[model samples]
Target: MFGPQVFLRLFVRINQDLWPWQVLAVVAAIGIPVLLFRQKRFERRLAVGLMAVAWAVSGYGFLVGYFGPINWPAVWFGWAFVAQGVLLAAAMFSGGVREAALPSGRFVALWLIVVCGLPWLAVAESGQWQALALFGIAPGTTAAAGALIVAVITGPWRWLYLPLLVLWSLFSAAMFWVLQAWWLLVAPMATLFLVGAGSWLSPRTAQSPD
Candidate 1:
């Protein structure tokens, strides 16, 4: 629960600290849906890879490097992110993830990707260049994207990471709570609940007739 200025500073400092990598983060986020929509064979892996980047960076870079200086709680948050990042990496080869969508929900998944990944940094405060909230650079934003991506993973353990992503969203909201950032909390929670519901209601892929 910090102030708006503080939130801005946190975001600005993080963006500054993660300069070049921030570009990579953007590319990765954009690349995911592109790959998925194109029906590329590597889309699932790409999604996981991007998620790994977001989790790892938000944990080690922001939580430790930036947020820790201001928030005492960030250290453990950092470790949590780091652990999740590790899990995401492991997920690639472990049969932990599969193609997104269960047939009827691909649209929803893509919608979430765009909403969470690339919204402008400071839509309300455009004059304040330093107050931007880019995806790869900000933990809350990154976690939002990560949660959405992991939510659709289709495997026996497809839902395995869902809880963690939800928890991360809550954790992000807590950070906003301290800062009284109602704007930030709304998106993540709404997305989390909506996606969870949609995924639950979505039809599974039909099997071919024998």
Candidate 2:
């Protein structure tokens, strides 16, 4: 369960006046690929659209306590948007929609270690155990669950991608909540870049044909 302090910190950070420039930058960064990438129109559209929706909801929640009255629903919807975005990106990169091969086992392993394992370790080392448990542990657990589900639905190698995408989305969300800095936009921005690049490099044609 999330702690009150964490929510308090997030509320304080987000409740500050919104910066129009920062919002524009985030939208632009997310929009570029949808405009440029024609090969994977469906995937790009889905990813960009979900990201836009999540960003708008988060921004609105920050501006007005739309959630303050019925907070759980807002939080649930917010995360649902993020989860959908993550899954859409995962499917795009993991050959669920198009012919995009999953990242290599070694690459996927390294990605998970850095994105998920390292963050958890860093939080624990810093003696922020509650934060670690809430943000690091819980997210890691859900990521593992997502990975398991992906593996069952796809394959073991495909499962590895979920942790990467989930961790990326979680870090992006945290940055937006804690810093209120536009630079935090880099997390998911980089994630989209990686997914597109990985798909290009390792085309899904390599997978065994059914």
Evaluated with lDDT, which candidate comes out highest?
1
Instruction: Name model 1 segments beyond 4 Å from true.
Output: 38-40, 100-127, 194-210
**lDDT measured at residue 141 in model 2 versus the true structure, 0 to 100:** 22
lDDT of 2 by residue, 23-49 (tens): 543453334334323455565445434
Error of 1 at 197 (Å): 5.5
Residue 31, model 2: lDDT of 44
Note the Cα lDDT for every prediction shown: 0.63, 0.39
Full-model lDDT, candidate 2: 0.39
Q: Could you tell me every candidate's TM-score relative to the true structure?
A: 0.77, 0.32
Clashes of each: 5, 1
43, model 1: CA deviation in Å?
Answer: 3.9
